[model samples]
Target: MPQIPPPQQQVTHVNPQTLEELPAPVMQQIQPITPGQVRSARSAMEDMSAAAKTSPLTPIPRISSQTVSLSAGASIPQVRVFPNQATTVTFSDATGHPWVLGAPPYNSSPCATGGELCVGYIPGSAVFTIQPTNAYASGNITVLLKGLATPVIINVKGAEPSVKSKTVDVDYRLDLRIPKRSPDTPVYTATPEKKISLYDKQLQSVLDGIPPEDAQRLKLKNAPGSTKVWQIGDELYVRSNMQLQDEFEKTLSAIDGTHVYVLPATPVLTFSVNGQARDVEVELN
Candidate 1:
């Protein structure tokens, strides 16, 4: 009875299986990686930083030549200022040559190669900047031309230190011009001629022309024979051609001090006192 019940429920239904099989999934293509890209970028950044550190330095320079020409009157010529460091400096000049600015050693401080020249500039202050390139004493400096012979005055404002520090500002400039030669030039000088003019009548007449005030101004002394004493001044004493400003000075070793005062203004003598040699305050009797 159990087997008959199972055979009665054996009905099977099969549907159409018409679905297409899907293609195998393909893997995504990956890009090839280049080597050292990160390292190159790091190296580039390092170079940029290094460039930023070294480019703005300026050092002081020495003056190679200096000249003053009287032909140009008071006008200053173009003077070149060089820096002692390896940095670049900007300067200016618009006038003639006499105003050409040059820098010298600052005070007691010596100017060394690859170092600062001095300090302080009034005209162009904002153009100054310090950098590592100025660590040395030689560098290219630019002087900008603003106006002419307006007296480009530059001074060293900072003190030079024995030890290097970033605090000091080194600057120096020159005010120069050709010195004019005076019109009254000494043309002829008397040479050492062994001729004595003491007894000459013409020389005595010439000597008589000298005022008593002039003779007193010279502190001329009268003495017997050739030996004479000329009391010149408290500090200065002259014997013959020798002049002495100090009592202990050995320059007048040949002159013996007799302290004799002379009358009349005579240029003839073996030795004579020159200049305002006496401080006599005499009252009239």
Candidate 2:
């Protein structure tokens, strides 16, 4: 049989600096830390410090303008952020593709109020470049300038709370003016009257039966002859001339409802048209 050696006994050392000194074996068992972990810990501290100083949210101003150009047709505008202010602006498209637009990039930096949030529209990429560090101010740029084709939601946060959002529609026509510098002013000019064909009495009777409420909404009372006419919400109540009643009845037969109420507009004397003064039957519509 092989013989086994007995374990050695441990001893403690006392020192002037401390009450106890650990055994040599105990001290040797402790492993040294790697440099990589130390570097990672330092980096984490730096990141936390940066986050503490930067704000997580921003705001945008409520802007109103009449000169919006809807030609872009659903693209977000480019935005420039001014100095000393910050805001958060968001954009969404019909495709469920969403992107953020503001002074600073969503997680980049902060914006300065009274500063510029310059938004330029690019139809292709639908991207906005926010310059939070830009030196421009609000008054220097036009907030209502039509840049994008689509609507955008803007949240302006800083000195004041403001929110604005709008979906723009495209204007199919070009805007032309006879050389005027001021957009704030209105331009008007009067021209000679033009002749137009008039509606006949039979047509007028049909027109007259129209209820004021319905006529006003359809704008049919004073429209031109060729305009394609269509009825609105409910079926109309109609009163017709006697001679036209039979013809009108056939027309009403196609329209489903008890809406047509026929009455004569004038009295018919039996003897007047024939040669005798017989009993007269008057038809009023």
In model 2, which regions exceed 4 Å deviation? 1-37, 49-53, 56-131, 134-137, 142-285
**lDDT (C-alpha, whole model) for all candidates:** 0.30, 0.29
What would the TM-scores of all predictions be?
0.20, 0.20
Model 2 lowest lDDT segment of ten: 189-198
lDDT of 2 at 5: 83
The superposed Cα distance between candidate 1 and the true structure at residue 125, in angstroms, equals 14
Residue 250, model 1, lDDT? 20
Q: Write the per-residue lDDT of candidate 2 for residues 153-266, one digit (tens) a residue.
A: 333211322334332221111111111112222233111012100112232233333334343222223222222122323322232221122212112110111112222222
> Residue by residue across 16-84, what tens digits does model 1's lDDT show?
576464443421223133348767878899999999765343434322112233342443333233234
Going through the candidates in order, what is the number of backbone clashes in each?
Answer: 48, 29
